[model samples]
Structure formats: C-alpha cells, structure tokens
Target: MYFIGELEGSSPDLKISLYKWNAKFFVKFETADLEQVYKISEMDVSEAEVRAMVTEEFIQKIIQRFKEMYEDLGELMGDY
Candidate 1:
C-alpha cells in the first residue's frame, strides 16, 4: 500500500510517499522545489506492536505537529 503526506516547512512544500510492503513501512520525503528527498524506515507490525514501539502520546504529538505544518503550508500558498 502507498500513501501520500504533506510537509510544510520554512523552505518549501514537501510530499511524503509512504510504502508498506513486506511487513515494513518506507517513508520518503520529497521537496517540491529543491528536488531533494530523504527516507526513513519503520518496521511493520501489529497495532499492539506499533504501540509498544512508540508511545501513543508521542504519536499524537507528531501527528499534531505535521497537521500544523500542513496547514501552514496551505496558508502560505493561499490555498487553504
């Protein structure tokens, strides 16, 4: 499965591609203007395993941060 996420930063808008295969998730972040990319890997496991790997609080915090970033990007682009 594949999913796309948006990243907002001072530099530029970014699109993140996430691929899930073979019980792992590969996340690739792509910068729209600079044509640069970075990737990180996360192990794929059951919901319980994921919860054990990362705390719910941490996950929620990260999600909130990203959502803010995305919203900021939309505002900067006047597309919100």
Candidate 2:
C-alpha cells in the first residue's frame, strides 16, 4: 500500500491516512493502539470525493466508534 495523504478537518487525536493498493483506496483512522480501515473502490470514488466524505459529523461518529472499540477491548481484557 502507498500512503497518499491525510484528510482535512479530521480530529487531531485521530491519525487519518489515505492509502492506495491495487484497485482500492484505504482510509485508515488511528488513535493510540486502535485503528479502523475503510475500503473504497477506485472505480467508485475519486480521491477528492473520499477526502470530502470525511466531514465533521463523520469524524464524530468515528470517534464514538473508537470509544466503543476501546470499551470492547477492555471487556475482553478483563477475561484474562
């Protein structure tokens, strides 16, 4: 995968990166030790469109999902 660039207006706490691999583009959001990746087909979306999709509301939802993921991981760790 080739690292493209980052989306504007993304949360500072989250590292948002664009990557290209074959016919797909990957948007990766990272905070601390956790990450979420979204796949988009090059045929379906342009890089500009992908960057435009990362609005403030979208970022808020991503942050919420990350919080939920951390909680889920905490629960799993409790089993050990």
Candidate 3:
C-alpha cells in the first residue's frame, strides 16, 4: 500500500510518500529535482516515544538537506 501527503513549512513545500511492504513502512520525500527516502521501523516503542522521535525540527532539517542535494544534482546535470 502507498500513501502520499504534503508538508508545508515556511521555507518550502514538501511532498511525502509512504509505502508499506511486508508490514514495514517506508517514507520518501519528493521535490521537483530530487527524491529522499527513509524507513520507519516497527518496534515496541511507546506512542509518546514515536511522537518525540520525529520532531518538526528534524523533519525540516531532512527537507532542507534533500532540497540542497537536489539542487546540487541539478547543477551537475546542467538542468539549470
């Protein structure tokens, strides 16, 4: 199964995709020029832990990194 969501922030808008395979869930972020992916492990952790784990600050950092990488790739590919 797959799901897609949009994440809006002050800097840039991000599109996040979720994929479920074999009971595990994976997340991918997409931008015009690049894609970034991550995996969420199904462990025996509390809901609070999960909430605390993925904070807004962390997500923003991830988005920024992905965007930077994407821009770099575009430069390398002469897509400017």
* Top TM-score model: 2
Clashes (N, CA, C under 3 Å) per candidate = 0, 0, 0
Q: Candidate 1, which segments miss by more than 4 Å at Cα?
A: 1-53
Can you rank all candidates by TM-score, best first? 2, 3, 1
Q: Whole-model lDDT for model 3 versus the true structure?
A: 0.60
Query: TM-score of each candidate?
Result: 0.33, 0.93, 0.58
Which one wins by TM-score: 1 or 2? 2
Collision pairs in model 2: none
Cα deviation of 41, candidate 2, in Å: 0.1
Residues 1-80, model 2: lDDT tens digits: 99999877656689999999999999999997899999999999999999988888998999999999999999999999
Quantify all predictions' global Cα lDDT against the true fold.
0.46, 0.91, 0.60
| True-vs-predicted CA distance for residue 7, candidate 1, Å | 20
Best by lDDT: 2
Model 2 bad stretches (over 4 Å): 10-12
